[model samples]
Target chain A: MATLDIKVLGPGCRNCVTLDKATRAAVAELGLDASIEKVEDYAQIASYNIMSTPGLVIDGTVVSSGRVPSPSEIKDLLLAAQA
Target chain B: MSLVDTLPSSKGKLALVGAGALALWGLAYWVNEWLWDWVMYGVLKLDSANRVVETVHFFVYDFLKIMLLLAGIIFVITFLRSYMSVERTRALLGGKRSGVGNVLAAGLGVITPFCSCSAVPAFIGFVAAGVPVGVTMSFLIASPLVNEIAIGLLLTLFGWQITLLYVVSGLAIAIVAGWVIGKFKPERWVEKFVFETKLHGEAIDPSRGLTIKQRVGIASGEVSTIIRKTWPYLVVGIGLGAIIHGWVPESFFTSVAGKDNLFAVPLVVLLGVPLYSNAAGILPLVESLYGAGLPIGTLLAFMMSVVALSLPELILLKRVLKPQLLGIFVGVTATGIILVGYLFNAIIP
Candidate 1:
């Protein structure tokens, strides 16, 4: 199986925290080797062109912006990315 | 690993810090009294009836008290704000039914520490996240108008009753105005570019693995940044309040905006719309207006108008909303605020 790369974008607020945790949990549940990275710098966040924080990017594609998805939902997204 | 870690982490240290802070706070009042006495009685030798002396005293005392109160309260609130992100709030309000969404958005707006400057970013974020336009409006209206800093300052200046009244009325306006705007289907007024803008790129979430120490550091940084950004406004607001409280003739405003004056509420609202300032900056002026015998309703209306309906905020919204939608938003919010002003004046006093 190929390792997955996940990126979460925010300014370290609680929502970003929650989403980061959920992504980790999903990756673990799927037994996937994923490198999860957090981007907190304002410039970097804006570079994504995302107006909202707490954005999720899986394998370079922006999956969600401005919200935290459930762990199950994250798991589905991760599995789909793997396939 | 470090010499700092060698110090004892004990209850005694905590107690000592607590006692020290309390003592300093208590000393602030004494300092205020001493300064006034020295300046007005000992040095200047001005009698109580001297309006200039009284105004100077008022300015000095209020400046000290309000600055202290603002620093402490802003620190705590900014610290609390660290836990709330706009993205999370958008998520919570997104995809809800209209009325409920408005209420929830308004409620959330009360807790979120957003200022007028953030309106554009929050608006785009909410819309992009699938939150209804009306619900987004509710959050935007309530966020600036019903902020914690404004509420804290109001509570410090006025008693709890007025603060509570402000909060309730502000929320009511936000919810109702948002619902009304929602009914109009104002989404048509949103710029086409907003819907078409696709945010793409690699992103990161720095908060993913923060330790407790990092969180505390972040909170401290936020406190410093907020105070730095807002201190000038605080000083100016309090300075204006002092002038109004001690120097301005009591009859000046009452003659024009007296409680019995039917046009005061709408007039004040009109006066407030073009001015742009944060709640903290405008609140001291509001407090002074109340002191100057402005009706509670008129003052409240004025405060809401200044905080919520400023032209700068409207211009910012223009990035996403068409002119017609912005007009509807302004009209609805203005009407709601005017009605609230009338309602409070009729009932409260």
Candidate 2:
């Protein structure tokens, strides 16, 4: 089983909520053993160099930002990452 | 007497209102110039730089002129409301299907200067009007980048090179960025409201002729509405422009933004995203950046961001789009802006 560390980063805004929901759904569908983390600290978020929030991080890499990824696209990437 | 009430008919009142507003503005300009000059030397410790100051001074003063021009434009739009129908839009931009032709149509998008952020209303209207996704995207991107005021100012200050670079890339980004948005037609990410406009009115029917009286009546109403809509924006916008014009220093801008700093270009793009500004307001800043030593790519990136990602326009767009699509637009625009900034410097002189 592949394990993934996913992060939904924002200031607890509405977009962050959507991204968190989307991330959970992606994680469950892919059947990957992943723990999702939400980073809301402004300083920490700024350190990531993302001016806008609701960014997605997979395995410490910011994969998608400024928008949430579609479930299918996320699942596909998860499948590939496991393989 | 109250300004609106004093005028006889609403339309006649508007003309009188226009005259009153201009009179107020002329007085304000004189006071502003005198106070600003004093502050420049006394508090700010800045003085006329061997006459470079005058040109630089024009940078800010010009925004005031633009505000006045906008007022005139509003008065015209008041009358134009009757004549400037979507049917007219179809007449002008319709019938041409060529890529180059489509681009030219898209270029005209900048002339409209609509809000840059994702809005349900414009997105709805464009889609409902059956404008292609790419074409709509081009207009969306370019609408904020180049406008008459911005272009005229660029031409006056920077000469042909800066102006040409601005126009070509502004059009190119509109086309390419639009195509990219089209490619990732993640329909699901678009909020429910955004799709509503697309649900109906997919085609434009033939235009009907208007009677002379109907035309005149509509024109008068349009002038009032458009003027009212555009005036608040102009006053607040020029107020900010005057500040940017007077305050931001050349040495500081050049030191940070200059050509040697490779990262400066993307830095500008990043900086521009949050601010609520238009091409007319931002052009002066961009010109100063170049004067200060900013790389062309960086300046262009900043310009696109200022035009495309301003907060007020973004708020307007959010009414139509879900937060996800909004984020995508901002993200995509940032990336596209940076890419084009580099492209322009490479292709042009």
Clashes of each: 6, 11
Question: Per-residue CA lDDT of candidate 2, range B222-292, in tens?
Answer: 34434444455555544544454556676676677565567876877878878656565555556544655
Each candidate's TM vs. the true structure? 0.75, 0.53
Per-residue lDDT for B64-113 in model 1, tens only?
Answer: 77767776677567656656656567667867989999999999998865
- The alpha-carbon lDDT assigned to residue B118 of candidate 1 equals 45
The whole-model lDDT of each prediction reads 0.75, 0.57
All candidates: DockQ: 0.12, 0.01
Best by DockQ: 1
TM (chain A) per model: 0.93, 0.86
CAPRI rating of model 2: incorrect
Q: For candidate 1, what is the total of clashing residue pairs?
A: 6
Runs of candidate 1 with Cα error greater than 4 angstroms are A1-83, B1-26, B43-49, B199-236
Report how far off residue B132 is in candidate 2 (Å).
4.0
Computed on C-alpha atoms, the DockQ of candidate 1 is: 0.12
Interface RMSD of each: 9.8, 19.7
